[model samples]
Each structure stands twice: as structure tokens, then as C-alpha cells.
Target: MNIRLHAGTLLFAVASFLMPTVLHADVFSPTMSYSYADGVALSPDVSYQFNEGIGLSPVVSYQYYEWPGDGVLQLSSSPRVSYLFYSYLGPTPALPTAFSTTSLPPTNMVARPRVPSGTQFLVYTSGAFASGVPLDTNKMTIVLTHGWMSSSDAWPKDMANVLTSQGFGATANIVAWDWRVNANLSAGLEISAARTPSEGEALGGELLYLLGANYNKPIHFMGHSLGTMVNCRAADFIHGDAKNSPGKIPGSTLKLNPQNTHMTMFDEAGAVGVANALSLVTYMLFLPTSGDTGDLINNFWTKVIPDHSAWIDNYISEVGRLHHEAANVLLWRRFAVPVISDISSGLHAYSYDWYSNTVAAPLISAIGHRFSFERNTLSPLPPSGTYFLQSADLIDSPFVVTPLDAATANSLSSGRALVYPTLQAYNGLNVAGNAYLNGLNAAGNVYLDGIQHAGDFLYDVTEWVLSDFNGQSAYVGTGTAGSTPAYMIPAGSAPLQFFWDLPFTLQKSTASPLALNGANGPIIHPADAGPDITNNTAVYVWLPVIVPSNTVGMSFEFKIVGAGTNEYMTMGVSNENYFTMESKFLDDGVWMSSGVIEISKYAGKQTQLFFSMNGDSGLPDGKLSVRGIQFLTVAPPTLNISVNGNQAVLSWPVITTGWQLEQTDALSSSNQWTDVTNAPGVLDYENTVTNVLNSGARFYRLKK
Candidate 1:
């Protein structure tokens, strides 16, 4: 049931560094073309020989270079990511321990410090880039950033050796961003994470120096643990390159993706025009050694990841109590990206070693089938799927390839254990052509069914909801019987972050509740609607936002910017991340409100505010805008009065939060209101209080 986003109608299951948004942007993942020169595509050096066998070079021979460290490049201006970098790493001098986007430098290159540190760049040349020498722009470039408490000798070098040995060394320039100074702390995990952005941004500057602003060669970014976010920030800081090449990340060098509602689905919720939205790298692969820090950081970077790269993949290895987890970057986008349980591997701290083994021989073994880039996607571009790997630790290479079907005894695809959104949202659970929930979005189904997921658990040390989706259960929060509730699917549940700062523009809407359901009916809904007449077959992509307390309604706008003939599109809003709850849809009008939304039913709940576009036409690359989201306090329950002979009975619908039944004389400023002495009794969802009539002119009112 999980179908993450990418170019066209969905944003990839990307990492947004600040917070995880349920947005799947449409991306154009292009195949890469490398530029190679000379016969030296044989060996990046003798180092990678044991890892991979393929080599790149015109001469088909191996050449080794004395890639020296701590050298200055001839580039003008210094790295602008930081004011000054220490000889090693620690809390950046002037930056805050918490994330603040404004605190970041603006230039594609931040102002470089006068002096640099051991945290320098390592290029793939015999000698470092001294004054005037640049990298071979013709060759493809790959950069590796390591995680906290790590250095170049660990997985970064292992990664470097494998990539080169995998036969790509000829047209490849592998660079290692050795940043042990800032990250060399065993007990300072939090401190190192705070330094991620600046460190990553600094790497962006170094990349510009190595590749130049307009370097057109293909680029790949690899990071482990905290390094994943570092790589994302670097890509965010890259500019001119993204703008120049359609095949390359435009938002990366050209510019970041336009102001996007990051956590929403595919295209316009209301419908906004998006020309070229790609992720940060040709391929941005994330690998975390253990903890949930990777999930939180990656969640924060989803904003940057979706707009910069053509393809994105996260190799998750569950090392309980070891390091970090690149868990849900692609999962909650309704993309069935699995949170591979390394515990499934029955090993500890061996995820790094095993994954490095995959990079060296990706498609040759059981585990390789999981980590291999050679996946089968319907699209012709580089394959994209959360590696569905299951096995015990590796020996030399990928050993065991156990698919989901083996464990569950179900004949599902690699990760198709439970379907999300459900076959229900696709009109019915058991569609005719669907091989279970395999391809729920064929013309037969028109939407993604759920797939295998680890369910919902708060994992990251920072406390981000592992899936960034918030809600208690797939079932609606009320007792009303649902005739066709598709209770059988992989469910993505609630949002109660564990610890990381909630750094967002948080404001609760004070508007009145609408009556789509009840003023207080549960808001969990599987949002989808059809215009019976025209049959607009458009793929609707919804953005998941946290509707603050009292948010009763929202205003949005959508337009069919460009589409094939007879293509029609509509927008919808929902309270669930995957839009599987009851929802509001706007089929007409340029500017309007999804008039049926109600939030009072589930107070104290963290639910999604989604904008989705669905139609029956060709892929409508439309523009959608959601604005004026307003929250309303629950209106006082209706106060009713009935005279039973001598006594007067007063009643109102029961309020979950205690309320007072007060009586006042006259409705003026000077009127004194007092609580009724008599206690009320509840009957049939209403509270009733009886009292004798008084002679004075008295008025009744309700108060907290």
C-alpha cells in the first residue's frame, strides 16, 4: 500500500531536515551519463580491487594517485557555509545548537572563513587541488560525508573503494569530506547533529570548488548517519548546477525547488504549476548505522531531497542501540519504503560492513538483491524502491535474500505485506486485475494500496513520529459503524514527537467547525472523490500538514496549468497522512474552502491537513495552493429549555471538557453571572439540569 512520490505527480519519499512532511513531489529522475577521459578508468587506485571488479578508464589500466590531505584549492573566495571552521569539529562557533533556516548563510556559497581546519576536502587526484587546478569535469563526481564520531577510514573510504571498484572508477571522481574535528565525539551525539547543516553546507561549497558552478557531469551523494543530512544541506546550498541542466538537479545548482508545501502528495493539492522538481543528486543514497536520528534529520531534509535528486534510496539497517535509522523518508509518502529490520539480520554493528559489501557487488547475492540498485521499476530511469532486504549478517557479500512472502506465507511482492490506503480507497479492496495490492495504481485501481511497513513507532532520538504521520489508529476516532471501513491494510499512525524541537510556524486556527461530519466527528478519513459526470482521471497527490488545535477549515486554490485534452483535476483535504480518512473535496471554483472539514471530534490529536489533486486525464502538472487554514473553538453546545409543569428543565449536548451552567440577569456588561447550584445528569449524549423558576428577569449562558 505504500507508494512514495517522485517527478510527475508525487514527490519522492524525501528527507526534510526540519520536520517530516507527508509530501510526495513529482520528479523527473533522469538516467546519468558520465564523462570519462584517458585509459585510466581502470582503477581509482588499487584500493577498490577487493570490493568491485569493474573499472573505468580509457587505457583499461589502474592508476594510483597520492591524494594528499590538508591542501588548499585555487578557488576564489572561501566556503560560505560557516563563518569559521575549527581544526576539528564541535558546536559551530556562531551557530545555534538548534536548527534555524534563517541562521544559514544565503549565498550559493557562504562567506568562507579566513582560516580553514582539518575538516577539509579530499579530491580524487594525484595531488590536491592547488591554485588553478579543477577536477576532471568530464568525469562523474561522487562525494561521501560520514556520520558523527566517524572519520574517512570507516565506511566513507569503504564506500569510496567499492564505488570505484564497481567498475565506475574511470569516469568517477570520488571525494571524501573528512570532518573528524566536528564529529569526533562519542558522547556528544546531540552536539554533532546540530553541526550537521553547517558542515553539510560547507561541503556544498567544497563541491563547487571541485566541480565548478556549471559542471554538467553526473553527481552522486552518499552519506551515512548524520552525514545524510549533511549531504542534503550541501545539495541545498548548491545552486547554478540545478538551474542549467534539466537532467541535473536544478534546485541544487540552478535553485532549490520553488516554495513547496513539502509534506503533501504528488502534484497540486489545489493545483500549482511545477516545471522541474528533482531531488539533490542523480542518486542520493542514505545509510544510517543505527538510531532514529537519521529519520528525523532525513525527515527535515525531505524538503531539499525531493527537489534536488532524480532518484533517491535509503538502505535502512535496524541496529537497535547502535546508531541511526534512515527509516521513513520514503515510507509515509504512501510509498512502500520498508524499514528493513537489521535485527532481521541477527547481527549488531555489522550493517555498515554488510551494506558496504552490497555496494561492491550489489546484484549478485541474496542480500545484494535487497541493496542492489538494479531493481525493477515500471519507469525506465534508475530504479527506486526502499531495499526490501531480510537476512542475517553478511560474510563476504550478500548472502541471504529472504523476501516478505517467506516470513508471512503470503504471495506478496518483495515488500507487499500489508496494503496501505487500502483496496477500499481504490474503490474496493479486491479489484479484478490487482495481484493483491501489488500495483494498486494501474488504470484498474488508480491509487496506491498499502505495502509492508514497520507500523508506527516513535523512534528518532529527537522524537519525530517515525513516519511523520500522526493519528492513533486507522479506525475513525468515533463509535459510528462504518459500512465499508477497509480495516485491513498496513496502517501509518500518530504524531507525538519524542524530543527534537518543534521548530515550525505553529498556530491554531480559531475558526468555527464545519458540519461535513459532525461539528465533533472524528476526522480520520480516506480522502477521494469523483465527479460522476466528467470522470477526471487525475492522480491526486496530497500534502500532510499538522492541523493545529481548533482548526476547523482551510482555504485553497487550484488551476489546471497544463494538461492533455479533456483532462480535469480536483483537490481534496484530509486528516490522515495517506488520505484514507473521511475528507473534503472541492470540485469547482478558482478559490474556495474544503467546506466539510471538522476537527473537534478528536481534540488533543495530531492529524494531517492534506491538499490532494485527483483527475482522470493525462498527468496534470498543475499548481495548487493551500492558505487561510483557520481553527475554531468548539461552539458552546446548544442550550435547550423545557418547562415540565412546576419545574424548569435546562439541557445541552454534553461537553468532554467540563463546562458550567450559569444564569445571569440580563445580557448587559453589568450583568452578574453565577453557576447553577444543581448538578446536571447525562442522558443520551446530553446533560440536563432542573431548577425552579425565579421571578427576576434571568438569562442563561454557558462557560468553561
Candidate 2:
């Protein structure tokens, strides 16, 4: 076969395998131009011919084109020859010491200042890395692998910068992997699915050659989606009997440690398989995409970490309704194709941007508790566990997910979980031909949506399991076989939650709740002498307040659950507290929201926040749990303003509920603010209210 290399177009970042999207134009079909065959709308020049000579084999002639439609690749009757002949994992373009983290802003802390190199600075960039740079054996090496149709310029480049910023670059060598030809999004998802081994071999072959030249260094391989499988194959090749290189690193000699990759923080993964995965629409929209190679991994690849790396840290999002970011139409069609099922995306959900943001700012929880990943580097293996986390609301939650131990993972088998016949991992000494859970990969059962043939052996080339469950397939009871009843369907369960996020956070005061509650997180006492004293019916105490100098949308916010008529909480700065805000916080704790208190009112001029309550000390309905709490920073709630005709409209997201609109004639430290009487109503996923345009300067906000 002949090949031609052309000057390719630069790429950008997306949640998954992304095709070109007409962001600023209409999506119209070019009628007389072409039509879709199966899922691909092929180029007019792409022609096929069968050889009249010898065996009369079919031949294809084609060149890459900038097509406007979707479906670049397709699933073939037979799998393509898997190799690095075309696909490869290459290095990044020569980077100036500086990187961009505009998409993911890092928190600047005095105690731990962010340098030019840190994981928080990760973002996508275009172009290729310069060649001929020698590997520095003495430095720490990090290899970022991309999934499916994505190029190195996307997540790999972005994440590399993030790692560099977190002090890893001071003594590190970073590289991003590129495998565009194999998994071209325009071609189709199957193309990417079939390319891992070939690219993995390519990466392994390159690393073997580079390391064999006496270039000894500690290497960390990080891949997202299909890239994870690429890493496994690469690791296997490096450790395998390759002609030139026998054992370099990330092989039998090294243990892999990864955080925020495909793995979630949940350790009881095998407990229910993908049956109990997160059903949150927010995560389903992004983290779980076509490139998430998790569904494709057989029993053999799952053991890669145990045999090769140190430890793996899976930080994934769990069950929730509220979306942190709005959904984009760009996710329709091509981007929506799942490798397994609609549930597959939710199973191993995580985003490259989310991973890079871990080392950035921290968030505050309801009742005023702070939560942040708060780490510097990825070296010195992180603790292993599946930790479920939440950070979408105004306030954040203070909970962590844990992973199961390695020793237990290999031997444990649940009736609810589909496992190998040996009751252990496939990579164990027990031999096997095929061991899928009979009906585990069936049409309607396994793949519930998207690519119906994704895991079926009939169409998808890599599908190794038989088509039928157990009833009458020529194959054995792989998915539906065994000593007991057919594990026909999943015993599904609901997602677990231990979080409560309000809208804002600060860095003032420390959490010193009463003795009975606990010593760790911020806690308020039922009968507090701390921030809320029980001396009389009138009680008040101070909390933290900070407005970042650089970013906008800064606000002082919190939520009190039970504050009712019996106990009302009052918020004020230095000399002013509004009657309107007190009323919002007085609805028997059922109705409460102070929205956003204008931060520009008092900047370096020293502004303080004190909460006062009018009522008895021991009222169970009062918000006494957050009495002596301090603060931190997460993204505060947002109130969008737009002009429609002569009217100015105010709106906030549906995720952030109970935020009351308030109008202040002058946003000042001594200004008296009043509530916007016309109650706002939900429309098109936003709480919207129309107000007549004011000729004078008037400020409005939504506080919870």
C-alpha cells in the first residue's frame, strides 16, 4: 500500500472524539454533492475497484479531505491489520516555558505558589513538537496519551502544561502522544477503537529504542479514554519479548499511578459492574464519550496496573442532576456515538479539563466547609481508592471516594458481577478461550444505546464474545453461562450521595465547631458560644470573605437549611445589614438565599461578613450546624443579564435554586438593598424575570 503525507490542519480540545463543528454557520446538506453510505457521507473522489487479475481482490483509492459531514471511518466485516504503520504516539511541539490555563484557572496560594509549570495550566494547543531533542535520563518523564480521534494538541498538550506548572517541569521531561490516522473522528469511532494496539506498539517500540540508548529515567504514562488501552498495550510491548529492548520501564519493573483518568474514585467497582454507574445527565453529556476505551478492555488488560505500575488513583464524578457547565450542540451526532452504551459514558466518566483543575482552587461546602484536591505533583504514588466527588453547585461537598485493594480485586467475584470462570482475573494462571458473561454483551442488554453493535462479535471487529447470551449460541455461556441461573439482566441500583453545595466560599476564619460535632471540617454548634453565641436572642459571628483580584463573578455566599420564623439569620458588613436579605434567610430555613453581595463594594478597604440570628439558641430548626465555619473558593453562582428589546432580563441557572433577586440602588458598604418583588420563574432551564430598563445605574444579584 502507498501512502502520502500532507500538511494537516491544527486541532482543538473537546470532551471526546471531536469532528469539525460549524459553530458559526448553519448545518445544511450539499444535495447534488454526496450522500451517506451507512453512517459516512463519503467524498465523491473515493472510489473502489476489484482487481480483474489473479484473485480479483477489492482495492480502494482515497485521500483525506476536509469534509463538512460526519462518519469518517466505519466498522468493517473484518478487522484491519493492527500496527503502527500509520498510527503513532508522538511528542508535543517545543513549548516555551510558558503555558495557558485560561480554561482552567489555578488558585494562587501564598503558601504554595503556582509556577509556570503545574497540572492546573493544562489546555489544548495546535501544531506538532519539534524533533531531535535528546531525552534527559536524569529528569522525570511524563507521557500523556490521547484517546480516539483526538490529537496530542488537545488534552495531551493541555495536561502536559498542567503537570509542568505543578513543579513537575523543574526536573521533568514531558511528551504528548498523537494517533490521528488510526482514530479519525470524521472517519467514525470504530477506527479509533481498532487503533490502540497498533499505536501502543508504536509508542512501545519508540520508547524501547529511546531507552535502549542508555537513557534511563522514571516514566509515567497518562492516557484518557482509548489512550488508557494504548498505555496497557505499550506497557505490555515494553515488557514483552521485543527484539531490541527487553525491559525498560512501565513494564514488570514499574507500577503505574494515575489520578483523574478513566477510573472513578469508587473502589467497589466490581460490586455491581456498570449497572450502578452514575446517571447524572451533567456527566453523561461529557465525561462519558466515544473515546472512553474502558468498555473495550477484556479481563487481560485490567490487570496491567497490578503487573506493571505502582498504584492507580481514579477520581471520577458521581450521581447528581445539576450540570456544572451547559450542554453544547457540538455533542450531537458524531460526538454522541458511544463505544458501548449510553451507560458506558457514565461508567468511567471524567474529563481531561477536570483532571487538570484538581491542583487549582478549593471549593466551599454548604454550612461553610472547604474542599479542594490540594496537591502539587503526581510523583510519589498517590493513595489508591475510588473517591466519589461533587463540585457543581454554589457550595461544594466534603466527601472522598476510595478504591479497592489490589489483592482483593483479582480474587473477589460476586454473583451480581460477571467474572472469569476461574473466579479470578483472566490474566491469572487459569487458561481460557473465551469467558464473557453469556448475555453480558447482547444487543439490547449490554449496549443500551448509541452503537448497538459496539460489543457484538457479528459486526465490530474487536468484539471477541459471541452474539447470543446463552439460550442457543454455538458458543459457551461466557456472558450468560456458569454454575447458577443466567445472569440475564443487571440488578441496577441508585447512585449514592453525601454532598451539599451552596454557591460561594472564602478563606477567612477557621472551622472550630463545638466539641461534640467533630474536629476536622467546619461545623456549627446547636448551642454555640463561637460564631453564634447563646447570650441572648440576638447573636452574631464572622465568616471569611475574599474577592479574587483577577477573575470576575466573585461573591460572598452561603446557605442555611433550617432558618425559619423561630430563628432568623442576618448578614451584614461593617455597618449595614439589609432587611430584605434577613427576610430571605428567615423562611423557617425552607426559603433562604442572599444571592451575590457585590464584592466591589469593599476591596482592599477591609470588608467583613458577620451572621446574626434572632431567636433561641437550641431551636432544632435553626441553621446551627455551620456556626463557627470558615471558607474557601469554588466557582460562585452566576446571574446573567441581557437586553431583549427595551426590557432588561435577569437569569441564573436551574442547577442553582432558591436564589432570590435583590436590587440595590447603589452597591455600597452602607447601601440599603431591597428585593425584586416580582418573583422569578423557571423558563428554558433558567430562572428568568423581566425588569424595565432603568436610566440610572442600578445593581441586581441572585444570592442563596
Candidate 3:
């Protein structure tokens, strides 16, 4: 999951820039609104159109609310539309006229450059509300949803600060959705505020009308916490409008349903009627922690509440029933078989007592701040066959009774750590080493053991044993019986990088045979984690950094700040024996150096790059801060050579690459290729070369 943590305090800065020229006249459009109360509602009927792909108007508005402090809330939800832009289209030349199409200037935006691959996340920003520079929404749209307790003015400035610092220039729009005070004070309030039928309908109508009046373009939406509900309401309105309009063209704003709302289902569940009421009535009632209200409810009902209520719990059950009913004539058994197995495998002990104490209590105290839950003497009974079983001999026991430390304890508590199962027996075959092994959190920086394969292999990447989890007993049989041992894996896997470029250099060496490599250059020997720099400055490295693909890049962007007029430093990357790359600085340090070099060339198959920084000499003691590091792609490999042998021979370079080769018959191209011989990290292949000789000539090529 892509989750943006809470940014610090909100800070605002305002500035103006020259407007861009007309690229897509449909980009700048007006929003539609209607009056309900006064002789003239807050906003007048000011119809606007996108002329020359630009709409510039001075927004002057004034409004008042009587309920909370009767203070005035000023807000604006502007629109910026434009034509499609493709990276391949090349650079857009700067126009000389005031209507130049130069990209907007960078604003205050901060972002953690490294994010786990495959995790869908969003960046949020709140600060002094101001108009955003007009740019292409396709590249990025800063969905400025305000917090309920505070106005958009209270949003953390760091998010926008970091993003602007990066290259996302002119790609953000400040959207201010003025919500009622206290709307998001808690999950319950957020839910109640969004579910208010009439109010929700009105908000939806306003947004839909605005999109229609503006450009006819689709938009990407993002909501934070309670903002998720508002976004959902907006989506509901758009769906309703689409249903009502039929053939009519809706606004250019494409309605995003659950896609835009990244709230935690656990939070939503906590906001549910039962959860909410219980929480409100009792200050001590615990509830599951969640990222946002929406997600809390969604995940809770789907993953946790199976037997809680008939209609509520039956949501997924209905899906099963539908499949079963249709299976009579459809042969749905093929799909249903797996579904049933999955559901059965998911059979978990349901107990309100466990949830209240374990999941809910801690989560509420941790994430919900001041909220409390009501206590009840009537505890929820555990499901049948789910009673907690105490171990007569904790040493020989396989299961951990405690839920929290079960996985961890099971591995450590075992007297004989090596006596557990191997990974193969659990899955029936080796599953490790395959690049296609997904759904594993490895894509998100979650490290599993890296697999080494000489043949067809399937297993998990692990170092720790399942026996470690015996501490709590919950993970007794989770590991492979004999083949897949109950070994517990370490916190995260290695390729562990320790970086330093300050007072001294980092000394690194495997205390227990840890593998290490380098890039750019290495200035020190291998040792454990310790300070190498003598000068007062901090070093940096990618924590738990591992490669997603064979080819990747690592670097640090550093800038000198403070009293030193000129800063002197040296930085490099190196492996156990050789230093690959290096850089030296002796002048006033104010510029950022970003260069890309090949890690595959040096590291070969799988190697770890240790980045080191040295503050050999500098004016004042200043530290080096690494801003970014990422991956790049290489050209596809070619099917260069092949030999017709008994097993069909194939040969290719032994390099770190993501390319592969496949072959087909020239005559019977429709038939699938047979057996083949291969090499690790090689791009070339010859499938059944010996067998293909009988069929005359064969065709082959490399694939990316």
C-alpha cells in the first residue's frame, strides 16, 4: 500500500508566474453552481469557457458559517485542463509571448524518493490555500483535500515542499474542498458527514456541474482520511449524473470511484455503526487501527467480520452463492474449486475478546489519539474448536498462543532451530528465485531470502525459521512440515547498504560471511557498522535496499549548506576488492550532481553496492544528505546463436539483465516450442535444437 505519513506543520508561500499559451482549449473551463437560500447565493451565475486553452479570472468570494464560531471560510476549487502529453513527444519549447507554454514553476513539495514497487500510494499536502500554477493534469494533480479539524491552511507544508523540490514542476493543482468543522474529528464523524444524503447529494451536484462546465477531461483524485469520504461522495454523484444524463456528455472530469479513495478499511469499520457507537459510549473499547476511515470499514468487513451479522457478513458469501448457482450448467467447478479452498484456508478463529484486546485496543490508542472505547463485562466467546490451548511443554511446542509474537516466537523458542521444515515440502516444489513470484511483499521493500536456482525451483526466500515464532504458538504449523522448515527470517533481507560521506569512511566486512559489492569506488575495507568519518557530519545509505530487476542504479545527491563558504569532500562506491566509481569536491558546494552508472557491469549477477562518503576536508562540519536513487532499463537481448543437440543447446552472456529468448518452427510456427537448454542471466536460447534439426530449420528471436 502506498501510504503518505502525516507531514509536519503547514507553511504557506504565494507567488505568480506568466500564464502558458493555448495547447488544449478544453483545459481551462468553468465550474457549474446553483443558489438555494439567499436572494443571491454566495456565488453568482458566472458562466465561463475555456478559450485558447486558458481560463484566467480573479476569484473574489466571501462566505460565513454560523455553527462553529460563525467564522468565514474562504475557499476555491479551480480547474486546469490541457492536451495529452507523451514523454516520447520530446521537450516543449518555451514560447516567448505572455501566453508562453513554459512549464509552471516548482512549488513547495516533499517526497521520499524511494517507494516500494507495486504499492499504490499517494502524496498529500495542506498549507496556506493558494491558487496553483496551471499545467497538465495528466502528469500529476495535487488533490488538495482539507482536514476537518483545520482548514487547508493546516495541511503539512513538507509534502508540497518536497514535490516542488523535485522535477514535478507545474504539475499540481491546489483543490480546496471546504468541509464543515469537526467533520473529520473522528472516523464516525467522517462517515456521518459523508453519508448525510442531502448534503452529499449537493456536494456531488456541485462537483459534477463544475466538471461539465469546465473541460471534458478525466481527472485523477486523491483523498486523505476523512477526505476519502468526500471523494467517495463526489464519485457517487458522478455515477448518478452519468446514469441520469444518458447520452449527454458529462464534464471532462472523469469520476474515480474507490480508486481515488485510499482510506484504510479498518478505519471505515471502526466508523461503522456498531464500532462507532461502542467506541463513543465506552472510552476503553479498542478497535482495529487503520490508515483512514474508508479503508478501516472496507477491510474489516471483508477480512474480519464473517459471522458478525447476516447481511453484513454475507457480502462475500453472495459472490460464492452466485458462482455455485451458475455452476450447474457452466462447469464453474474449475474456478469454484480454488475459491472454496481459499475460503477454507482462510478459516480463522473469531472472537470479539481477542479483537477488542489485541487488534482494537492497541490500534485505537496508537492511531485514534484521544478517542476511547466503552468496556463491557460480556466478552465475546471464541468460535468452536478455536479455544486457546496451553502447552504442557513450551520447549517442545510448535504453536505460539499469543497472537502478536506468534510468528516471531515460533522461530526462536524452538530448542532445535535446524530441526524445522525446508521451504520445498510446504509448497510441494521449489518456488524461490522466480522473478514472477508476486503477491509477496518483496516488491514493497519487504525482503524474503534471495533464491539461487540451477533448475526448475519453487520456494520462499527465507533465512529465519518458523521455529522462532514458537514464542506465541500462533504460527505452529505455518511453516513447511519437513521440506519447508519453521525457520524465522530476519527483519528484512540483505544487500543491506551502509553509506557514509562525512568526517570518515565506513568500514564493512561480513562478520558471518555477508556478501558485499561496490560502485563508483570503495575507499575503505569491509567491517561491521561503525563511524568512519571524524568530522561532525552524517552519512547515508538505502536501508534494506534490494534490486527489483537485475539492472539498477544507486547514487546520492548532496548539497553543502551552512557557514562553510566552500566545502571539501570525497564520495565513492566499492565492493570487497575494488572501487568502481568516485567523485571529489573542493569548491563552494552548492550544486547537485546526479549521474547514472551501470551496477550490472561490475556486480554481475547479484551484488550489493556499498556507498561511502568522506569529509576529507571542509569549511564547517556539514553532513551529506542523499536525495535520490533509482533503476533504469537496458536494451533487449538477442537470440544470437543456437546448436542442435540432444537437449537443444542455447548460449548467452552471463550478465545481470531482464531479457529472454524463445524459438519456434519455421514451418510449424503455430506449434509451441519443445525442450531447451539455458544459462543464468543469459539472453540467448536454442529450444530443442537437436529435435528441430529433424524439422529442417527453426526460427528464433530474443524478447525483452
Native-to-model Cα distance after best TM-score fit, residue 533 in candidate 3, in Å: 7.0
lDDT at position 550, candidate 2: 16
Candidate 1 per-residue lDDT over residues 96-115, each given as its tens digit:
11211112112211111112
Highest-lDDT candidate: 1
Q: lDDT per model, in order?
A: 0.33, 0.32, 0.25
Q: Model 1 segments beyond 4 Å from truth?
A: 1-119, 125-133, 185-187, 239-306, 319-349, 366-387, 392-398, 405-704
The C-alpha stretches of model 2 lying farther than 4 A from their native spots are 1-128, 213-216, 241-306, 317-350, 360-387, 391-394, 397-474, 477-704
lDDT string for model 3 (274-376, tens) is 1111111111111111221111212111121111111110001101111111000001001111111111111010111122232223332221101111111
TM accuracy, model 1? 0.32
lDDT of 1: 0.33
589 Cα displacement, candidate 3 (Å) = 2.5
**Order by TM-score, highest first:** 1, 2, 3
